[model samples]
Target: MKRVYNFNAGPAALPKQVLHRAQEELLDFQDTGMSVMELSHRSKEYEKVHQKAATLLQELLQIPNDYEILFMQGGASLQFSAIPLNFLPSDKTANYSLSGSWSEKALKEAQKIGSTHTSSTAKETGYSTIPSQLTLSTDAAYLHITSNNTIFGTQWWEFPSTPSYIPLIADMSSDILSRTINVEDFSLIYAGAQKNLGPSGVTVVIIKKELLEQCPSNIPTMLNYQTHAKNKSLYNTPPTFSIYMLSLVLDWVAEQGGIEAMERINKEKAELLYETIDQSEGFYIGHAEKDARSHMNVTFNLPSEELTSNFLIQAKEEGFVGLGGHRMVGGCRASIYNAVPLESCQALADFMKSFQAKNR
Candidate 1:
């Protein structure tokens, strides 16, 4: 079987080993006579799969004992509202740094729930750069930041500091497990699994125990972080198949080494593509500045719209998929998520070089 170089931003490529493992167990999971997708989340067999995924995630992240790992639904977008509903107290302001499209949406959702302060913004740059520093208020309930801007292809090398006592929340959907992070630096972190984790149906949340304890009451049971924490993310069925796949993916990651190892490989992959763009000598123009370039998604443009169109068409003919950019901006994007092999990146870089040579 052949596989194309897959660079879709979300609902993206998954590790082939994870896919194969799922295929092997799809008919009978752990000697059970039922598929994992068909099992009741309450079943003992399914529970093992569910718990193992959480355990692997905890081990991989080296998450602090004080943080509660949750597997929730409704994607990270749901957390946009749920976060404010649970943590943004009526008397306090939620501080936000307007970094990109997702953060803008999160800020908009928070504005509807309670008072919000825009501490900093990069709107002037079309969301191509992150704010170097932010001015968060001590009275703020939570300071929210999007660690990686998926659409604009920019990311924070380091987060801006907030007031010491204030909780720092981040929507790290695109870059969740792509690197090593000091989990303690965040009071809460949420990510949609489609990018780096597993699949679209699962959303992973890591929240400080104190923060979960502080989650306000009267919010809908499903929308409340405390409810999920109390229920161990089994308040409802949870995504059994997706969690199973995530467990396999985590195993693959561990086999490759831990997050530091993943980060190193990701760095190498990103540099290959970025170097291709930079060396194109005006044949390609990158959307983000060098320092802010994302290690996951690399966005750029060809010399002309026609060349861009032909490049995509040719790339597809050569077995590349999802090389197009987000709709908000019309360009090219190559999302080199963890599942994408370094050899694939090398091939793409080679393709880019050849494409430029023939066209130029």
Candidate 2:
């Protein structure tokens, strides 16, 4: 079978070795005569898996001792409501920075529950660049920002410096684990595991312990951060299979030299593809500004929509998948997540060069 390079935005490519390891342990995990999915989440065996996944993540990200990593269901979208429900009261307002579609959705959800003020909006710029400065409300519950805008292909090169009293909350679903970061900088960081961690169905929430104390007790027990933190993310049956897969992926990440090494490779891959687009003359046009371009998702357009369609069709024939852009933005998006090897980037770059040479 031909090895196709997958670039799906979510439910994206995972390391080949992780897949092979899972295949080996599919039927019986660690001499146990049952698949991991077949095992009960409450069982000691599964407990070890859960703990290890969280531990490795803490170590890799250097998550502060005060932070608790909670693996819960209902992707980052759920967090949009949950964050506000848990932290913001009907009377208090939270500050949000709208950089892309996801952040906008999050802001809307916050508005549904309570008042949410916008510190900055990139809508005026067509989401092509990150906001230079944000005027946040000093009394707001927290300042929310989407660290990486996947669809718009922009990223916050550096987080805005906010007042120490107001905690910063970040939606890092698309770019989590792609680079080394100071986890202490944010009060809460949430990501859907599909992009850089593992698969969908599980969202990882890293929150400082003090944040948990601030969660309102009046909210539903299930949505309460304290509940999940107290229960150790086994509040319900949990996304056992997804969590198990995430454990394997986190293990793979550690073996690959942790986030620092991943950062190096990610930089190389993104630079190679961006350089190709920039040097393509009028043939390829990048969507985001050079400084704000995302290392995980690269959005670009061809000279014409017709050419874009033709390029995608040819790309599939050449073993490239998921090069199509989000429907909201009509263009091409190359999501080179952590698992997408550098060689795959080279393949796509070579294809772009050849296609541009023929069409331009």
Candidate 3:
């Protein structure tokens, strides 16, 4: 079987091993005689899959016992509304740092719910940079930030320091599990499963149990963190197939030596592509600044629109996929997530060099 070098931003590539394992169990999952997709969420078999995914994630991230892992739906976008609904009070203001498109979306959601403050923003720089100075509020309900901005190709190398009295919430949809993180540092973290966890239809939410206590009593049952936490993320039917795949992916991550290994390989892959861009002598112009470059999504532009269009066409013809940038930000973006092999990045680097040589 052949595979293309995939670089889509989301709903991206997953480990081949995980896909194989899922294939093997598709018809008969541990002699249950039914596809995992057809299994009841309450069944012992499904529970094992559910708990295993959570446990592996906890172990991999070294999450404190105080944190509860809940598999919620609606991606990180939904959490934009859910976070302010659950935590933001009429009296206290919610603070957000505007890093990129995702962060701006989250800020918009918070604004609808209550008073919000922008601690800092890179909007003035066209989201091409991560703000170095964050103006945090001590009395705010929570300080929100997006750990990685997929569109702008920027990531936070250093998180803002907030007092324990104020909650720090992060939308880590694009970069979770790609590197090691101090889970205890944030009061809450949410990531949609499509990027690094599994597939779509599931969003992993890890929150300090103490934060659940602050969940207002009047919010919708499903939106309350306490509801999912109490039922262990099985409050509703849940996304069985995605969780199963997530467990398999976690297993693959563990087999490859956990976060440290993922981080090392990810750095190598990003460096290979970034080095190609840096050495191109103005043939390529990177979107994000050097200090805030994302290891997952590398965004750049060619010397002209015609060259960029030709590059995308040739890239696709050469079995490279998703090299086109987002419409909001015109250019090219190569999303090299955790599951993307180093060989693929190297191949892309070679292709980029060749494309430049001919076009130049």
The candidate that achieves the highest lDDT relative to the unseen native structure = 3
Query: lDDT values of the candidates?
Result: 0.91, 0.92, 0.93
List TM-score per model, in order.
Answer: 0.98, 0.99, 0.99
Q: In candidate 3, which residue ranges exceed 4 Å CA deviation? A: none
Least well predicted 10-residue stretch by lDDT in candidate 1:
130-139
lDDT per residue as tens, model 1, 1-360: 888889898999998988988899889888888888999999988889889999999999999789999999999999999999999998899999988899999999999999999989999988778875578776799899999999999999988766668989999999999999989999999999999998889999999999888776788989989889999999888988888888899999999898889999999999999999999898989999898999999999997899999999999999999999999898899998999999999999999999999999
TM-score between model 3 and native: 0.99
Question: What range of 10 consecutive residues in model 2 has the weakest lDDT sum?
Answer: 131-140
lDDT of 1 at 105: 99
Please give the distance, in angstroms, between residue 84's alpha carbon in candidate 1 and its true position after superposition: 0.5
Over 1-360, each residue of candidate 2 has an lDDT whose tens digit, in order, gives: 566899899889999999999999999998779999999999999999989889989998999899999998889999999999988876678999999999999999999888888999999999999976688765688899999998999999899867777889999999999998899899999999999999898999999999899888888988899999999999888998888899999999999999999999999999999999989876899999998999999999998989999999999999999999999898999999999999999999999999998987
Q: Report the Cα lDDT for candidate 1.
A: 0.91
Give the higher-lDDT candidate: 1 or 3. Answer: 3
Candidate 2 Cα lDDT to native: 0.92
